[model samples]
Target: MKRIFILGAIFTLALNWSCGNKKTTEPPVVKPPVVSKPPEAFAGFLTVLTNDASRKIEIYDPTIENWNAAEAKKWSWAPTTALGFVTADINTFGGGTDFKLRKVPVWNNAEYAALTDNGFAAIIEYPSGKRKWSKRLSGNLHSAELLPNGNIAIAASDGGWVRLYASSQGPDQEYYAEYPLISAHAVLWDPKTNVLWVTGQHAITKAHIITALAVGGTDAVPELTEIDSWRTTIPSAWGHEVSAYYGNDNLLWVTSNGGEYVYNKTTKTFSPAPTAGLTFVKGIANQPSGQIVLTRPDYNKNPRPAMNCGLNDWSTSTVDFYSANGQLDGSRVVNGACFYKVKLLNSSYQ
Candidate 1:
């Protein structure tokens, strides 16, 4: 009986050892969850001029998403040696030699054909390889804007006229009218009210004139009524150098060779904004956050002078951000030849 009890005790010990070994063994390997990188932030598109041998129109997308350096995409039609402005549509339009107006077809997407010095009123399609329409103007077009109603608003410098052209029946129908001022250069259309705003130098003097066009008229006659007129408070200075109207604020911002001013349509008063850091401010764009972005001409110096520079040069270009309280929040130096215009792609993007 004693011998049998010993054997049974040994068997019980062996079973306990096997159970312990099984519990100590490793379990199946488990994997970790996959992590995804964040999506890149999209910086607003910028119009830059190429400094290389081509001197072409380059569109810079400052990949704000990934915080990467700006990537430049060039256009086939070069605006070299020309005074021009780049519209937000990635179209570079400017006055060529001898008032020959031209536009780059569209940046990126090679399917579209390029436009090189097409006539004064050539309408190049965005991202499409086709010229929608073109019309001959009475004089050299200094500036042009595409209206929301699919028409083109143009300001002539020599003739001092503002005209509107509508595409109808496969041809551009032109409606032209004379304004009070000759040498009108800048023009814009207010999408909210379909009002056309025209700016130019008074034919007889250095003073500037602003006119509002009568909309929905088959006749090209823009009502010559002056919305606002001003002479440079400073001697021998020009007023109404550049004008932009903000639809959100209903304010008209104008900058001249002398200074910058904002007109409150509600109050019918004009107030001056800070132009100390601005030299030859060419474009005024309003952002979604009630801020303004100003673009200016290029500087000529290396280690480009900061925004505080009093002179206008190729190296002096900057983007100034202004809040609703009329205070400058910050500024970034811009490297581009002849920074003629700055536009906000979307208010929300800012």
Candidate 2:
């Protein structure tokens, strides 16, 4: 009887301990609160004035949201358009004379020489304030890319041709070779194949063509004659121009007054895309990370609420960005007192 009572007590105590352990181990069935992730890092744009002495090329550091303009003053000149950067002339006003000097040299027979006019190229650097190795070309250079050999390949307007150049050569040197191009505005070099991939013009009047140049010999001609050419029947009478980009899935993303068009390179044609809130699309830039930046006039016209209107209203001069798939990302209004061109720095900020 005593053994039976002891065994019963032990079993009851073990059951009680097991029940207590289960209760403590199992957490309450409460749900966790939801959290929404912040949006992606937005691209940035700035209004640049040709006359504004303070205007400069800025480098933005995303980590600290800080902008460093140390390289601005060192630049010989900068392009005036929003189509990225272009080579420009560097001129020194009132040559080599201090304003406080006794023999002050006044403006005389000094002429503005073509510091570096190898066609439409951008000044990448001007280390010693001299035009050395200032890229030279045969055709009208619309865009340039610096190569690993300290040379540059410029996309010329003459045909889909790209001219190569070395920094040690002069403007009169014959380092340029003709590569097939058709109305291309921007040319990017592919180091992998030593070839060039060009971005053609946007407008119908301008040829809608993109070409790829194969790399090999210095005297070698363009390997691929033509990659693709697209034509649209959309009426382009109102000074409407077309801009295109090679987007994801081998799709060509084009923009015009008629709206956005996506052209499948495989099918060799174009189809309209959704551009509901977009307007006055002048320039389009497709980033490698599937984001796009476009320049357009501000749509907030006069008599609209939330916008202060005045004679000095410069809101029309602005640029906005959208996602790679065509979503309204964000926008920034240029802060110049006067209306002018706006350009995006090659950096991202909040």
TM-score of each: 0.57, 0.46
- Model 2, residue 52: what's the lDDT? 20
Highest-lDDT candidate: 1
Estimate the Cα RMSD of every predicted model relative to the unseen true structure: 27.4, 24.3
lDDT for predicted candidate 1 compared with the true structure: 0.40
- Candidate 1 TM-score, true structure as reference: 0.57
Q: Per-residue CA lDDT of candidate 1, range 268-323, in tens?
A: 45566533323234456554445556654333122344442332231123544555
Candidate maximizing TM-score: 1
> Which portions of model 1 miss their true places by more than 4 Å?
1-58, 62-119, 135-140, 168-175, 191-193, 203-206, 219-237, 240-247, 274-277, 299-336, 346-350
lDDT of 1 at 43: 36
Please give the lDDT score at residue 109 for candidate 2.
Answer: 20
Clashes of each: 13, 13
Superposed Cα deviation of residue 2, candidate 2 (Å): 98
